[model samples]
Target: MAFIQIIEGRTSRFDEMQALTEEFRERSEGASTVRRGIETRDRDDPNRFMVLVFFDSYESAMENSNRPETDEFSQKMMELVDGPPTFHNLDVLKDETS
Candidate 1:
C-alpha cells in the first residue's frame, strides 16, 4: 500500500524555510519511490507549515530519511524551525484518480 509522511512545525524563519522547501521540491523530483508532495501553511497560523509527502510504500518513505538531499534539507530545516519537527506516518487507505 501507499504511504504518506507528514512533517509539521512552526518556523521562525519562514523565508529561509521556504527557500529550502523549494530546493526540496526540485531535489525530490528524482526520488524513485516518491509519488508526489504537498506543502501548506495554516491559514490561521502563518508560521506553522506542513509538508505531506507520498511514497510508493512505507519502506520508500523511510528511505527518504537516508537520502543525501533529504539529509541536507533536514539539517537546514532544523536550524530554521522551532524545536523538532513532528512526523506522522499514515497508511494511504483510498487514493483515487480521476
Candidate 2:
C-alpha cells in the first residue's frame, strides 16, 4: 500500500530549509524511495509549514528514513525550526485523481 508521512513545523528559515531539501534530493537521486514530496505553508500562519512525503510502501519509507543522508538532513532541518516537528505516519486507504 502507498504510504504518506506528514511533517509539520514552524520555521522562520524557509529559504534555507528549501535549499536543504533540494540538496537532499540531489544527493539521494536514483536511490531515494520518495515517490513525491509536497511542501506547504499555512495560509493563516506563514511560519507554520507541512511536508507531505509519499512512498510506495511503509517499508520503503523506513528504508529512506534509515539512510545517512536522511539523518543529516533531519538534524540540519531541526536546527532551522522553532521547535521539534510533529510527524504523522499514514497508510493510504484510498487515492483517486480526476
Candidate 3:
C-alpha cells in the first residue's frame, strides 16, 4: 500500500514556489521511496496550491522527513508560503482501474 501526504497552502510567490518544488524533487529523487508527486493550483485563486506526494510506505516518508535536504526544502517552502501549510496523511486502502 502506498502512503500519501497532501499539502495545501497559499503562496503569493507562486512562481518561486514552483521553482522550489522542482528543486525539492531534484534533491529527493535519490530516495526511491518517493513513488510520485503532483502539484495543482486553484483556478479561482492561483496562489492557492496543493501538492500530493506518494511514498512506498509511511516509514519511508518518515525517513524522508528526517533528511537534512528535506529540512532545508521545508524551510524554503515555509518562507514562500503566505501561511502554514495543511497536511493530510493517508494510507491508500485501494487503487482500482476499470
The model with the greatest TM-score is: 2
Instruction: Rank candidates, lDDT, best first.
Output: 2, 3, 1
Ranking by TM-score: 2, 3, 1
TM-score of candidate 2 relative to the true fold = 0.97
Query: Looking at candidate 2, what is the lDDT of residue 57?
Result: 100
Please, what is the whole-model Cα lDDT of each candidate in the order they appear?
Answer: 0.86, 0.97, 0.90
Winner by TM-score between candidate 3 and candidate 2: 2
Higher-lDDT candidate of 1 and 2: 2
What are the clashing pairs of model 3?
none
Task: Kindly give the stretch of ten consecutive residues in candidate 3 with the minimal lDDT sum.
Answer: 26-35
Better structure of 1 and 3 per lDDT: 3
lDDT, candidate 2, 1-98, per-residue tens: 99999999999998999999999999999999999999999999989999999999999999999999999999999999999999999999999999
- Reference-based lDDT, residue 41, model 1: 90
Best by lDDT: 2
**Residue range with the least summed lDDT across 10 consecutive positions in model 2:** 12-21
